[model samples]
Target: MGIKLDEEKGLTLLEVLLSIVLLVIILTSFASFFTQSAMFVKKNEDKLSTTQTAQQIVNQIEVSLSKNDVKTSSVCGTLPCLLEKKELSNLLGSPITSSFNISAKFADSVEGLIRVKVSVTDIKNPENSSETFTYIRR
Candidate 1:
């Protein structure tokens, strides 16, 4: 009877340890899943914000081209161009601005189109940059 009682106690101890191990594994898996979900949400939000910025930049450029007097030249030849936020605001006739840096490069080609590249960086994560490519026909 004493030996049987000791065996029963040992078995209980083993069961308790196994239960603890299983609980730890389940908790670890849940934590990992939560972490990955959070990361995915953050990334998606960044992408959406970047896309909005790109759209705003494109609209400003389009408005500028439509309203301003621009001549089609074989070469850019120092045509008035600006890549700064303040200068862009003045050109677009708007007070809108963004934290992301903006740049514009006019491609000289016989197609009579200007290639515009708008790049927007995530304000929270500067290492991530989203670029939008478009063309403006004269």
Candidate 2:
């Protein structure tokens, strides 16, 4: 007997199932790509945030050095001379104080010249950190 008109016009069960399987395969392949891309974006954002935070700390250090009354001695000689963490935090103020563990150090880059280094560790991810450096006088 000839096939019914409705049956002939519609997709068979096997055809429908194959289409679904193909869709799932395509979607799964693309899913991994999206996930990896998201992770990459997040990592870069974190890195940029770290660098910006470090830069802010460096700017503060520079400002402190530029002051006429700023006191620094020629010690440590390129080795980092640690600054008090609380003092650094107080200098940074509210915007950055809560988000990072800040460490600062200065060394004698040359006679009467100092090299300032500011390092910031992300509070949420301690292993993630950035350091910024600058040279200042006295």
Best by lDDT: 2
Q: How many residue pairs clash in each candidate?
A: 0, 0
Q: What is the C-alpha lDDT profile of model 2 across 1-138, one tens digit per residue?
A: 876776457788999999999999999999999999999999889888889988877776676554222343332223446765575554434234547787777665666676778888888988788888888774
After superposing candidate 1, which stretches have Cα over 4 Å from the reference? Answer: 1-17, 67-82
Model 1 earns a TM-score of 0.68
TM-score of predicted structure 2 = 0.76
**Model 1 weakest 10-residue run by lDDT:** 67-76
Candidate 1, pairs of clashing residues: none
Off by over 4 Å in 2: 1-7, 67-80, 89-96
